[model samples]
Target: MVRRARPVLSSLGPVTLDRTGVEPLHRQLYRALRQAVIEGRLRPGERLPPTRALADEWGLSRNTVVTAYDTLLAEGYITGKVGAGSFVASALPDAPPQGGPGRGDARRGVGLSRRGVALAAVGGDMRDPSGRPFALGTPDLNAFPFAVWAQLLARSWRVAGRGLAVDPDPLGHPPLRAAIAGYLRAVRAVRCEADQVVIVSGAQQGLSLVAQLLLDPGDSVWVENPGWPGNRAALLGAGARLVPVPLDHEGIDVEEGVRRGGDARLALVTPSHQFPLGVTMSLRRRLQLLDWAAARDAWIVEDDYDSEFRYAGPPLAALQGLDGAGRVLYVGSFSKALFPALRLGYVVVPPDLVGAVRAARRHFDGGTSIVPQAALHRFMADGHFAAHLRAMRALYADKRAGFLRTLDRCFAGLGRAEAGEAGLHALVHLPEDRPDRTLSALAKRVGLTVPALSDYYTASERRAAGEEPVGNGLMLGFAAHEAEALDRAARELADLAAAMA
Candidate 1:
């Protein structure tokens, strides 16, 4: 047998070893050394002390130190050579400076651009509350045909040829676009051809695309006061100045929008069932908005989200249907109808504006994934989409009725439901003296997320528009949760409110 030469081991810098419960000694050593590398305690290319020396110093087994060093080596925190021991990586991954002078300032967003800062200012602490009781803008996932969707998804790949293998259309899958156009025309009465329907990731993306493609910096755009906060972010990020137009029993106050920004470049409205308030836009206002866009050489963006769940008769005709001037760009999402994770929505643009929107969307994300687009087309083509909507409409109608009854029983004389004839949520207006914001926070502590109505408004906008804010109320969603769960949550919420009151 050949005689083996023992490799020389060099001494490393001193480090404290943690022998705390549950955590392995090797992992403890790994964390300390990795932190040292990250914090520049161990400078780049500095050789680490030999594992045996560290093991001996810290009363740890030699194997523990070796394992720790091995982990560091794997994570690129250190490098090892046959005889040279380990050295700190010459080039390390970016990590925030920690526990040193000026470290706090470095992480305080001091270097953000003006737009970045502006975007940050407009941001809210909005968290995903899917499957949570009374969570808005989400559908009943338990009722969705997920198994059917899975089958369709599998079929999209299994039975398909090169169509599924290649990149999707910059606009969308042609069949899906045509299907959307046909569906919109038949159901929502939106006027468009297959070419005019562009599939976007979601309605929010469609709004952002419209903002970037149409409006210029400082261009005034009409936005509803207490409207969707997301619309504000998208438009503001695109450098458009927002003119907050108030809403009434009718949809967006058309005359008021013109007063605020008559020459506005665009008007974004949730006309079909105005979000939160859930009011359907009067036909007169729809006509007035369309005429305003026509006369002022402007455009209108109609967000028709969640219209399919209308509790009354067939959902009202889309505001886009009345736009004879082809001035309306209709945005709708399937998140409320199907599920949020699908991330599927469509924009029906004017026939003339189709090319520009498609070009802009091409650069935004090339296009939404072809797999879902193809699957959705098949879903629509086979009539499953309509059938699902029918079932959900009936189910939600029952839930809506049960929810209203529960609210009446729980919040009698204390609050009244102000939601319109349709949509997933009820706007319960509390006595003005009962602060909804305080109540909303209190509800959150108990695992509830009832949104305060006042949080939706821009106070200055409400003041400037000479309109009183929607005032102390909570938007309680009823679609995602079953009637029993919603009733329980509503009763719990009422108890909390009564205690505070």
Candidate 2:
């Protein structure tokens, strides 16, 4: 019988093994232990040292070591039984097979690229609430007009009994597509025919369809640096070489975009209200980007994710409306304005790309739920959609104002909060001395749910010109909170920041 080696505790960096620093001893130990486990330095099923022995060795309190072990157990990095101490988690079934890449030497003819190998190495982690009373993207379910929607849904079922059971059009239900087209033209100023509209499950599906149609492996795709992480992930997952274009106050730097060279085949932009940063792209840059797309024969993916709630100014014209050269694919969703779980959004493909996107949609999921599509069509055609948007805009605007007021009252002395102008979230740039991750960690300790802008950056782009590290700011979602709740949440967040300071 062979004996397994005991797991060795590895240090992430030199630690004083004392609890005197800003970070608690338990947290420092937890991070160090977690890093070792993730790096595979601690093999699966290996037993860890007893907490008391570890504490004695590290000159720390037994409670501190126990807390670190508890954290590891909670995170599934280690397992514990009543009588037994914790051990490294059993080898994950999905973990790479032993002997690594050469294990598949018999299939050497089945060539996979370096990027594929790299992507395969990535693993998933469970998402947990930050535990702070901070505002997140989840909407106040009470505010959703579920009763009216239910009525509409019932009416839809009544009107389309047997038809509802049939497969929907690949482009979406005809009535729904027409309704969406009309709504976009009326509200967003987007000129699109029903034929161009394809109903997708959500913005994510739309992105996937666009990626399928426009992206080829190794194609350079420009995405805003401090933008939507999901967009970056989707583009990269589609095998495009992501170019992180820096963002300015007016949104993505158009000139920097121009300098990135015009050869990049696609640019995914959220022009109405840029995510994380929450800056609107200026009209001048919008035109310039369109021209650049036309000149380079590149495609523009205009993700109008949450443009309906313009608290300060009139909503800007969607870039799709200005796409005379048909280089833009316009995407919009009911998720933000109405509700996220609706799982309905549409993409207006350029005439040439319509066939490809339609074919892709057919293979992807065929179409969105016909019942929801019909109900949405009814909602829009009957003016209910416009009414709902007006109510939500007003509610979100008040919530935004309340959030700002709370920041002004509680955090004014700490630092200035960026007036997001129009979006679910605002970016609060903390003092340069206060790292965003530190703030986020502190906020999480206090049960807040704010996301740092640094979390949105692509792994490769996170390093500076010389590969030095950089920090990003926090994203505070206000739309999810009621005016009163937003104020309370902001105040709580302010207190957390003040404590950190």
Candidate 3:
């Protein structure tokens, strides 16, 4: 009689035996299965060997194989059906689409476009918040001196009868402008008169005003690649064609800026702490950019977003400070340093552009709120603002150190963390095989949230479309958490990373 042929076992890839026994059998099985799924050796909806069969083949108990399968399911490596056993999860690569379906045509019949903007597309989600959530650009509210600010507000309001009754200047309150000018001189080394300062709502408003002042439709505006998405959106919304200049360890490639010559009229830069990458623009590059601007007669919008939190050494002077020619429009915001809701920031315009900016401001919001301006003026004049920065600098430094230490212990040799010298967040680069969405999804499962670095890019085509792109990483914010809480959060993140790996 012919014997029954043995059932063909599904190949979950080769599992190695650890004679040292440091690695657990279940972990080895899980890793092998995970690799198979991730590497596409195990196709989506393809059935795997039954737990009993796998266990028998591998010389392990049924419980061991079952445990491995359960782990894979929990981590989203594979899916298990009631009667059909287990199969690999669907794998969709995240890369820029190669001329796929048109967005307008695909949703033509549907009225979904009338709804609010997609949060994922714009990088602003309702779920973004402070308190150990890894939300980028959020300041530490607990560290802000509310008591001192209250006193300043009360004092400003007490004198409000005269300050509020009078019609405020279209260029913002004079005292506040003077205070800002003084602070910029002392801190940023920017030489600006009070009249040159135009107080706007925030950096976004400043950007809008700059766009209105400079851009004619179809004008070219050079923005940093893998930079701030909000700025790119604002520029595009104003109808200017965006030219993304690639960034390196030194900062934006100045030579590329010269090479992509067009009717390029503006170049926006975050020189102090280059946004997501966190590298400061070298003095040579800063001078080169300024010279380029001067040669082209183009405007440079220098966003000094979080320059005040530099911990390693003395803060670098603002690029506006070094502007011998009147080309750099320096923008500063109290939002990152103070609070987001304050809606207070000032733009130091070139003397030539001040009148136009003021005219644009009048047509826009008719100038910022009077009460907050008065209170902020009082805050600046009373030295409380400096004190606040001093306190926050120390606090943020400790938190930054804690985060770096924890990440070092966790990721170790797996990958490197870039731009930890300054700013609220650091850009952690992952392996080419890892996708940021996977990290984000895994992080969410463990109650942590991280902003994907790719979200900052200007062009959607820059990132892989369907499957999560390989150049995956996170922009981790440290400003919002206390040192102790940050340490705890880091440990939790490390544990998650190990499990995912």
Measured against the true structure, the TM-scores of the candidates, in listed sequence, are 0.77, 0.78, 0.75
What are the lDDT figures for the candidates, one per model?
Answer: 0.79, 0.73, 0.75
* Ranked candidates, highest TM-score first: 2, 1, 3
Better-scoring candidate (TM-score), 2 or 3: 2
lDDT of 3 by residue, 131-181 (tens): 546777789898788887887778887867575867678789899999999
Question: What root-mean-square deviation over C-alphas does model 3 reach?
Answer: 10.7
Kindly report which residue stretches of model 1 are placed more than 4 angstroms away from their true locations once superposed.
1-108, 123-127, 461-467
Show the colliding residue pairs in model 2: 131-447, 132-447, 132-448, 133-447
Best by TM-score: 2
Q: After superposition, how far is residue 116 of candidate 1 from its true place, in Å?
A: 2.4
Judging by lDDT, tell me the better candidate of 2 and 3. 3
**RMSD in Å for model 2:** 7.9
Q: Candidate 3, overall lDDT?
A: 0.75
Q: Tens digits of per-residue lDDT for model 2 on 429-491?
A: 778656675566455544566666675665442363445244456777766556676677777
lDDT of 1 by residue, 121-158 (tens): 56363334546778787778889988899999999888
